[model samples]
Target: MSFTSDQAVEALRAAGEPTRLRVLTLLAGDELSVMELSRILDQSQPRVSRHLKLMADAGLIERFPDGARVFYRLSSDLAARRLVDMVLDLLEDGAADQDHVRLEEVRREREAEAAAYFEQVAPRWDQMRSLYVCESAVEAAIERAAGPGPFDRVVDLGTGSGRMLTLLGKKARLCIGLDLSQNMLNIARSNTAKAGLDKVELRHGDIFATRLPGQSADLVIVHQVLHYLIDPAAAVREAARLVAPGGRLLIVDFAPHALEQLREEHQHRRLGFSDAEIAGWLREAGLATSAPIALPPDTEDLTVTIWTATRAETAKRSVA
Candidate 1:
């Protein structure tokens, strides 16, 4: 994606302002709302938004409206992205010490809000998710990633509503679902029972330390769960550990986005995740990952991604 002379000049000119440069620095850390930027910069909303509009117009940044709020991030365009990166690299870290400190404060506030929101909305989790992304499409994609598995054992981490259990239960001889919320587990129990999967087992357990034996399951799934965790990579490693030799791990979550309202209203610690980030974690756990499949929404909502990874069959042969 080579930048034309005009595009390069516009981007450089848009980012030339001191305030706009600061905005880019903050956004380089994470996407931010105009209000957030205003607070961090001690400027009025109208004034801050003017700077954002200029940068966004020049393709130096991107603006997305998530429900009632709008957020901005560095442009996803490769040429514009490269320009921002090179320019950011030249800016001294010390120039924005106070801004970073303020950003941390905003981050903590978001975490607290998400935690409180999670407590309030645990019961209607599935229905809420259905409002965001089409479940049928995501489920079909998940089933495809899972393939035909008369698996010996299957494990589902953060199994809210036991939807995964119900979807995969009939295919497994032993099915286990673990979650930190007993209330959610209860909901899962009722859902799985309604599906006539009486043999399915539900446990109130932590995804980060399931305490389940390593390499115990033929299929391990972490569906729509990673975004809530403070340590998603750790959870991925834990999920990978439970995959048996030659078994598969399927992760379903949203692709990278700038949906700020989801963070404020629905307790999403992350807007979404990138392919390289998730694949890197799987690789670190000694699993081979396939190219991720994305299912973009019909509207301006989130895009769901399915990542499938497998433990090498050679590992089993070697151990034997």
Candidate 2:
């Protein structure tokens, strides 16, 4: 990917500054809100916002809002990412030691908060699963849909409890499980180790921006995670971006229910999703989806649906 001459100069001008360069360096690993940026940089929120605005306007970074908070990350465009990466590569190591140290502390605090919540909920997850539906039935359906394969690389987004990793571990050469909660990651680590999945790797990461290589995963699984996201379609697009050409993405979630209780109690941003809605999202992400397989409970519990979408072998490479 190549940028226009003018765009190259513009991106450079945006990143050429001292503060903006530090911002790019910090964002390379994870997305940060303006408040977090301000805390790490020890700059006023207004000043940090100003730096973010310049980088965003120059296309060196992307800005998004979640509720009342606005967040920024390195640009998702291929050419823009390439330029930012090249510029950051020129900076000497430890160029801003203080900034790096503060950044680590801010991230740790965020993880600790998330860890506390997960720790409180992790024990009840199995009980919740049983209340919603039969856990064994869901696992069997996922395993059958995933197919027995000697996959090169398998990625499990929102890998909570590492159950999926244990199920798919023996079928893959490598297994990577990502979760936002450090406590959940610890659980997954223990569970996978007990299962003897020596090749499994766990990361505290965002599903929307994994930073993993594009088109490298033979299989990508997003099991029962979309309901918690503010934008389920965006999650699907990000998951699809990781699938290798001709590879498949498997999503397991609810099939549209009137479970109003789940919304308030479970932190569900969306109650459930319809098959057509999910298929549309997959299609928009440049994947062809087949009919979804639904497993309903005997009572009025939530019904779990599994949707598998495939990318054509001739599909274009992901931008990032």
TM-scores vs. true structure, each candidate:
0.65, 0.64
Among residues 3 or more apart in sequence or in different chains, the pairs in candidate 2 whose N, CA or C atoms overlap within 3 Å are none
Model 1, position 273, has a per-residue lDDT of: 80
Candidate 1 residues 263-299, lDDT tens each?
A: 6566776677889779988998889999999998756
**Error in Å for residue 31 of model 1:** 16
Provide the lDDT at 143 for model 2: 91
- Runs of candidate 2 with Cα error greater than 4 angstroms are 1-116
Alpha-carbon runs more than 4 Å astray in model 1: 1-116, 316-320
Q: For residues 1-320, could you state the per-residue lDDT of candidate 2 as single tens digits?
A: 67789988888899999999999998886667798889988899999999999999989998865445676878878898988889889999888688879987875664455456566787566466567778888899889888878888999999988889999899999999998877788888998999999999999998878888888898999998987764467789899999999888999998877666664566654566778778978998888898899998646667899999988999887757
Location of the lowest summed lDDT over 10 successive residues in candidate 2: 109-118
